[model samples]
Target: MLKVQEIREIIKLVDQSSINEFTYETNGTKVSMKKAAENVVVQSQPVVQVEKEVTAVQPTQATAQPVQQEVKETVEPTAKESTVNFDHEITSPMVGTFYAAPNPESDPYVSVGSKVNKDTVVCIVEAMKLFNEIEAEVSGKIVEILVENGELVEYGQPLFRVKTK
Candidate 1:
């Protein structure tokens, strides 16, 4: 039987590393872990696996239960970079969908050469069914948008570049 502390340690190790899937098997214990989005799913069973084959095995003693947790992870996004020179970028605060307009037919919040101040809303980042308005933190003229509408964005991913005043 694996201790609770040991299981927690394993989860910690998996969360901090880049590996998305992990599995461990021993004499009487088998552990499999997979991360989906910001959540970690842990499955612990008393079974044996050998050489890419799975075999049913019984535990020698009592077994531990499965555990699941919501891990706050800032996953990396596949982004293309455009030329930027001395421009400040407006970044997303969470991993979600990015929308340039409030609705499908509405005009975008800002575009190239649009003058904006710190209080101006530049875009919206929707996460978990909630739409959050994103603001331009610096007074500037919009230079370029780095992401496409309806694209998935990661935390700290640059959305727009602004040539500050």
Candidate 2:
């Protein structure tokens, strides 16, 4: 049987590659995975016009003119880029529903500012009816929680950012 860590690595590799599906079988154990097709919705944004003064200079003459320009500004940071200062990241090993605790009635496994070690269980990702405990994987204080409880997480999605000792 393949170990959980090995399986996680395989899932990461498969998710990053162009292959849409993969299967492995050996010694009576089998693992199969398929990538879900994504639907992209494109929304049109209203165009903004900015009026600016421009100076045109030539060897013989110089002239000033008013020009109209369209400029779009965005300041959102992506998942990896947003956590640049963090020392470690706890990521989901498979696509599943993320659970902050073992059950709804229980307290969350970890919260912001919670201290944890490499072996500390931080959350659970339920895939195909099986609950897989996700560990801290690094000794650190939780700097941020990237996903809400019960959210659907994709494979290798960052769950927590940690500031390591």
Find the candidate with the highest TM-score and give its number: 2
lDDT by residue (1-165, candidate 2, tens digit) is 566787676666556555465554444444666777742222222223345555543343365544445445544322234734688889999977789999999999999999999999999987767899999989989998988886656677788999999
Clashes in model 1: which pairs?
A: none
Model 1 whole-model lDDT (C-alpha atoms): 0.76
If candidate 2 were superposed on the true structure by all CA atoms, what would the RMSD be? Answer: 12.4
**Model 2 alpha-carbon drift over 4 Å, by segment:** 1-84
lDDT of 1 by residue, 63-131 (tens): 754443443433332234467664698999986678999999999999988999999999998776789
Off by over 4 Å in 1: 1-82
Model 2 gets an lDDT of: 0.72
Task: Give the per-residue Cα lDDT of candidate 2 at 155.
Answer: 76
lDDT of each: 0.76, 0.72
